[model samples]
Target: MADPLSPFRSSLLPVGVRELAPHANPVTAILMGRGGSLRLHLHGARVEGDMLLIRPGVVHGVVLPTRGADIIYLNGLDFPSDAPLAEALEGKLAQLAGGALEGGRDAVDELRACLAASASATLPSVADVVRAIYDDPMRRMPQGELALRLGLERTKALRCFKAVTGQGFREFKLWSAVQYAAAQMKEGALVRTAAMDAGFADTAHLSRVFRRVFGLTPSAAIAGLSVN
Candidate 1:
């Protein structure tokens, strides 16, 4: 699928029967095991089911068979709440259950439809700012500079950002950067390089935040092997 949004990215991971450390994302993540099932610990809550929807920053620990399972990363969409969005996601799950990767591609249309349905009512107040961050998370200008660019006061900008994303701008920036770095690691980037590129102070910093947010170290996630 051609993602015109440019910022949003999605991919299917390798297939296997495996378990990895519990991890959280800075962006929306759709996780489903084979047969559209999963054993999950979400935000310290135990949930086992056919599918699980994780919002940005929600901690999730997954346990799979000795082999491993596949993962699909869905980014650039807000957490779905309204019926249309929910139904669309459920539809995608149905596609997965049917044993078709087509669902992953089809998800783009569903996401757009849901986005429209949600926007038909009222969109987030800071839609433009949010889009900028969503587009290039690493390029977030300083609050003062961003405020000037948006032609708003810094305080107003902060409030708008928080109201729309339910995250402090600084925190959101960090999460976005860290997730990008993690993605680099998944793609085989060295820890040092990923840290530098993702705007982290150092590998140790990435390791600390990564462990705190995802409940596992970077290497552990890469190996897809963890004890708990």
Candidate 2:
């Protein structure tokens, strides 16, 4: 078998796994299928019928329906985190849950059509670029070394990234780092430890970014959610 694990760009599949496993990424996945059971461990979640929302860095095992299911996996980069369009997609999922079982065949066809249209589009969305950079931040991975690897001029590469993502390259880069680091902190990683582990200058640096993005210091946010 050809690795059954076929990996492709965000545009390539109805289902697949990401490399690096659990790199702190500001990405998400939307899975719509039937009769499949999935075990996911990560932040951010919501589900409906055969649909599932996946947070970045989550480890999971999915059991496809014995009868087989048509799954559509949408990554955050291609779909905004919380936006009107994404909300509309969520609405469709809700519709699927409410009496759309009878239309499973139609729904699957529709999803495949949408995927085809999305693949042929000329301009990528802002969400796509943001998710792309976030998916690989160290500038070490293939996606990270985009400009160098693709042999594109630095300026051109940045232009393409920004045009599609609606964010400055640097901004998305830092934000992606912050998101991953924050997730670790939430998992009870020590302040300084999480910060350093996340490639920050130190805990203080991480604290500042955390406050800026989430409107609360990392310590305060974690404290607010503490069980004890």
TM-scores of the candidates in the order shown: 0.68, 0.45
- lDDT tens digits, residue span 1-228, model 1: 333443334544433435546656555555555544566665555655555555566556677654555545454456664321111236644454223233445565454344331443113335555566656745755898657655779998787666555567887777767677777877888888988888777889989987776556777666662221
List ranges where model 1 is wrong by over 4 Å. 1-27, 42-45, 55-60, 70-76, 81-93, 96-106, 115-117, 120-140, 225-228
Give lDDT tens digits, candidate 2, residues 1-228. 111121222321222221112222234444444444433333443232345444433343343333322223322234434432122234654454222233354453344334332433323343344445556544422334656643567778777765554345676567667666766765788888777766788788888776554435666555543422
In model 1, the clashing pairs are 16-68, 16-69, 17-67, 17-68, 18-67, 18-68, 22-214, 36-50
Model 2 worst lDDT run, 10 consecutive residues: 1-10
Off by over 4 Å in 2: 1-145
- Give the number of the best model, judged by TM-score: 1
- TM-score of candidate 2 relative to the true fold: 0.45
**For every candidate structure, what is the RMSD over all alpha carbons to the true structure, in angstroms?**
5.4, 12.7
